[model samples]
Target: MNEESNSKGIAMDLLQHFEDILESDPLIDELGFIHPSQFDLLNEESGISCNSFDEANCQSTDKILSEQSSKQENVYFWNKDHKLGISTHILLPLYKDAKHSFLTALKRYKTCSNQSNKDGDCLPASSSCDLESLLMRHSRSLLLLSCDFMTAWNSRKLVVSKKKQHSMFLNELILSGLVLSYSPKSEQAWNHRRWVIKSISAISSNLKDILEKESELVEKIAERSKMNYRAWNHRCWLISYMTREQVIDELKKSRSWAELHVADNCCFHYRSQLMLKIMKDSSCLVETVSFSHMVDIDKAWKDELDWNGTLIKRYVGREALWLYRRFISSCWINHFLTDSGDASHHFKESITNYHDFGTFLKKELCLIDYCSTVVDNEFGDFEAQAMHSASYLLWLKVKVPKPLENELLEKMRVIELKTLVEKSYPERSSLFNYFMS
Candidate 1:
């Protein structure tokens, strides 16, 4: 019985040690699980091995942890470099205790909050404050151990939101970022981040820096996490809040990353969304639009169209590029070629003045004509190029502005495009014929 009591005492002490470490280090950005043997290896020099959670070993581990705490330092073995590691052996004990404590505090917090403002029905003010603090600390630890716990995350949100403390909201950002450090794809963590942002934006005004930081965070995560659709989706969602100048800046900044990742349709989609936003904003102006900004927008279109052509020529068979072209081409004809210069507003009658759009259509025809003539390679990339080009032209046929609706007939024939598709991709020839004819 003495031995069992001693072990329990050490376990509680170990839990306190972890709590103290977290309290001391608010900058811990990453958390991971480590093997018990590895934890022992880390403590070899201190003459302590936590290979067994038995009473004797537990006592020694607690002593060393105290010594390290007293010394005001912790190295990479368990906590260092702004990262915290948990031993697999103690994971169950630690998680159980942490989660239990968090849930208890959360229940008390809910009770306190549910009580009317009339007063004596709930715990006293001091006690309620302590309960909220306890919930926050416990929820942090629980989330580090298990990020998918929506209740814990939602509980934290409730506490922070009820208090509406700016510092507390910032701390929530740090907490969610820590969760994302390990589980970048955790939808709960990401959603919690969005919630925090929404809450903050409701009160704070100068959010340009905050939005920029969020964009950078997405890019940094995307670098390490491949094909992260959620991250990109979050970035695209941020476009709504950005200033027009910031939108243009984002366009210039994200170009390099997009170029390096030509195949990532999400990134291209992000770019298209940004471009469309600029057009939408320019058109929605009740006042006259900025001439300089309009000129810049025109230059942006020219650069993008030329850049798309260069990318298509350099990297043949990229479906993403073709798709991007279709979007930009549609945007160009509707916004630039039309008289009103607003695609989203309405399509005006500019058919007789289709001189500019007619030229744009000619450029597109030449591109597909070049791609379809390329010889097939071992990977059949040329064939894919032909199919995408053929498809783009066919799509453009139906999508052209109503004003220039019949103008495409004079520039390119549907029969010729179907033949281009059939040349390298005979299998889809009938499908193309059915759609085009």
Candidate 2:
């Protein structure tokens, strides 16, 4: 009984501290406020005291006064900005109130949870309902202050389960989104949102609509903060539920976004994931007399390669674009240009009119030549960006199969490329020599 009374008294004291701080603005101002006239008065006092001293003492007094005057000027300048002190006034009340409320709710929830765990039986329905309401209210309040509060989130989960409030999962989705609005990178909040969505998927029939809106939400968040891997990851998760056509639509929509953010490797990585999904969809492989679906997929792949080439040409010295090129090239070789006799007939037919393996090799070499020329002209010899471009070309020369007609010339070009890079970037000469050998 005394512990309960003591807890209530502590809560009240915390609340009173909040009120006192909120009302102490005038006191804070009085303590901080200084006037120009005060400096004059201090100087006058120093002068008067110096008059009663010897010559040496008077010099020391003057020096001390000058230092004191400088300090006063600095303080006065700092205090002139009113908003500087207002943050403490605003945050003190919020922290005190949030701490008090969070502790109180946590104590009650822990007690209820402990009792249920010990008894191995659920609480009475009415008690469970009341506790659920309490937990929901306080947890929401606490999460608004600190979105990553895992303990509060777990307690709310317990309450929802005890009360069988599965319907509340939708509301939890809304709440999680609200939390994410302020703390977009909060892993705990994002994880909770995923759990809420999964729960709703099991119970609700409108999951398609929910997931579509979720995809839009994630896109908006990604736009606001470029290179947000978490938002991109969530969008990738949404693709599993979407149809092949829907996934393709999303891919086309994100093309411009990815192009604009060429340095963001996450966007490129997400695009690769989407393409993999499309490639794996058996429904997309159904043939038509005039045009096979594989033809359309091939066209998409070609367009992506063209787009990547354009970006690489436009933005010289971007490792991300080079990395994306490698991804596209690897996917192309594995899916369309496989030398294995076991390759699918549909895949071979799709690339019949499109560039064959040799043509693709020539096109990639031409791109490398273009990048090297641009890097040379824009960023002179020995630039690190040039080294990056050279390294990528060297990697391609080794990884890609040589063309039939000019294999010797291609090998000579590779040797020249390595020699030029070795001369320009002597630091990496050893690695370049290893590649050459």
Which prediction has the highest TM-score against the true structure?
1
Instruction: Candidate 2: list runs displaced more than 4 Å.
Output: 1-127, 161-167, 282-291, 339-355, 374-385, 401-416, 430-437
Query: Which portions of model 1 show Cα errors greater than 4 Å?
Result: 1-11, 36-77, 113-118, 121-125, 290-292, 338-355, 402-406, 413-418, 431-437
TM-score of each model, in listed order: 0.83, 0.68
What TM value does model 2 have?
A: 0.68
> Which lDDT tens digits does candidate 2 get at residues 108-165?
7678768888986457868766766666766765675577778888877766555445
- For residue 380, what is the lDDT in candidate 1? 73
Q: Tell me the lDDT of model 2 at 305.
A: 91
lDDT of 1 by residue, 1-437 (tens): 66556655655666667777788778888777776456555556546444443331232343232223343222222765577777665666677778877888888777777784555658767888898889888888888888999899988887788888888888887888878877889899888878888888899877798789889988888988988998898899889889999999999899989888888888889999999998888777624655555666767887898898889888889999999998888777766665564432322332223336667778888888888766756767887887788788778878886777677867786337656767756776777656544
lDDT of 1: 0.75
Rate residue 13 of model 2 by lDDT.
46
What does the lDDT read for residue 235 in candidate 2? 79
What's model 1's TM-score? Answer: 0.83
What residue pairs are clashing in model 1? none
